[model samples]
Target: MDADLLKTFLAVIRQGSFVGAAEQVGRTQSAVSQQIQRLEGLVGGPLLVRTSRAIRLTVAGERFVEYAQRLVDLADEAKRAVHGLAVQRTLRVGIVEDLAGFALAEILRRLHDEAPSLQLEIHSASTRELLPLLGFRYDVVIGMKPLASRGGVELSRLSLCWLGEWQGGPVPLALHPDGCGMRQAAIQALDAAGIDWRAAIVADGILPNIAIVRAGLAVTVLADALCPADLPRSQGLPALQPLSLRLFAHEEADRQATETLGRIISETLGAAVC
Candidate 1:
């Protein structure tokens, strides 16, 4: 019945765990668990089955999800209408540098065409640096899902490919600095395959690494979507696991605006991968 409780319930569902939901809602895990318990009590049944691996909705919870979302949306709409709050005019978006190429251009073009009056601010960084700023500094963030964590709506799962030509002897690699999920995957795969590699260039963002690859100085790991057509995918290398692209919207962000951006991003990236 309470909109806040419903919102928290949705956060848990979206985030896939109480800990992730707490991070998304800016609450402690204990508080999130308590809120879920209160919501379950109000609904007169258990809503979730929690396990160490995942959180699954009960049949009652599955049936209630749509109504809960509707109630929360109506509540937000009612508050805005009653209070005469101005529609949100600015959207701050953060994206990983890897996706800042054609994918970003298409996404921005669509967003502007649909919401012409809305102002936009964009930041490009590595996934490691973008996630932390999701709620506090940006209204929405598009980044790679961390290997160990679960949260955010998935936009696409892209196969990781080795880009650029591979010359002989001690494989040269241009990688993003420490914290990058792709870099970690590349290193682990190489080590596991017993291949010798040298970090020819260590950069903070994707552009420099891309440049290195372009110059044929080193090979880099990137999503298949972001790999340049001219830069060939290496024939012999350890296959890396697919990386998931995810969208994170701040819990307190303007619902309409965030949803619009999220939809455009999903459609744009989803189509690109397909």
Candidate 2:
């Protein structure tokens, strides 16, 4: 039995929606749905029932939840027995919202399991903000930048695309508030191409931005990995350049814990990019 599948199931149960669970676990909603489908197949029955607004556990899921908890508890106990105990440390980690939505949960879980006493203070923001927060405010920051930019090891490079509905005339844009790398890429691409566009909905955070796009308010530039399947890529739009996610560390923090956490995050999200 895969512990990850169990955890994913529990996350869906707790979150009540795949989108919410994906954010909680740091996986795409599509990935979360696939995990649930895999778990149902393994269990030989449906575990979740999806309504228009929320997801509910089926009878099989309810029964399996208890076993899942016990299994995870036993696994944690076994790990603790082998590694002994962990020392107390407060870890301040700054992560770009894009990466956080893809693989934040598992990375944080790995760090906690590896060092039981590590208390995490997570700050999720756009790469533009997270980059500056590194060292001064955060122990480490996981951010996205143009592939051409030097500094930090590249974890993944993703192709960005315009996503949402096209209602004709002056492209309506649902953009991230000023400081986002994706926003800059979109603006630059449109300007370079001499395309006319307007910020129909200027929002902060991925969820709100996605909501605005889904409502057909405006189109936004997003990585193929993070974009939901239902949101069609807008046609006849200027091509946006690719971006690379990289890691930045502050030497002032605890080297061992920071390095370990960074390795876990990089390993978890390496495949999320194009």
Candidate 2: count the clashes.
2
Per-candidate RMSD vs. true structure?
22.5, 22.9
| Span of ten consecutive residues with least summed lDDT in model 2 | 81-90
Estimate every model's Cα lDDT from 0 to 1. Answer: 0.85, 0.83
Badly placed stretches (over 4 Å) of model 1 are 1-85, 271-274
Best by lDDT: 1
lDDT of 2 by residue, 1-274 (tens): 8888888889888888898899998999999999989989999999999999788888988899999999888888888776754446777889888768866777778887887778878888887777777787898787888878889767778789899888668888888887677888999998998888998888778888888888888899888776677887898888888888787877787878877887777677666666
Quality of model 1 by C-alpha lDDT: 0.85
What is the Cα-based TM-score of model 1?
A: 0.64
lDDT of 1 by residue, 45-122 (tens): 999999889999999999999999999999999998866536548878898877887488888899889987677788
Candidate 2 residue runs with Cα over 4 Å from true position = 1-86, 113-117
TM-score of each: 0.64, 0.61
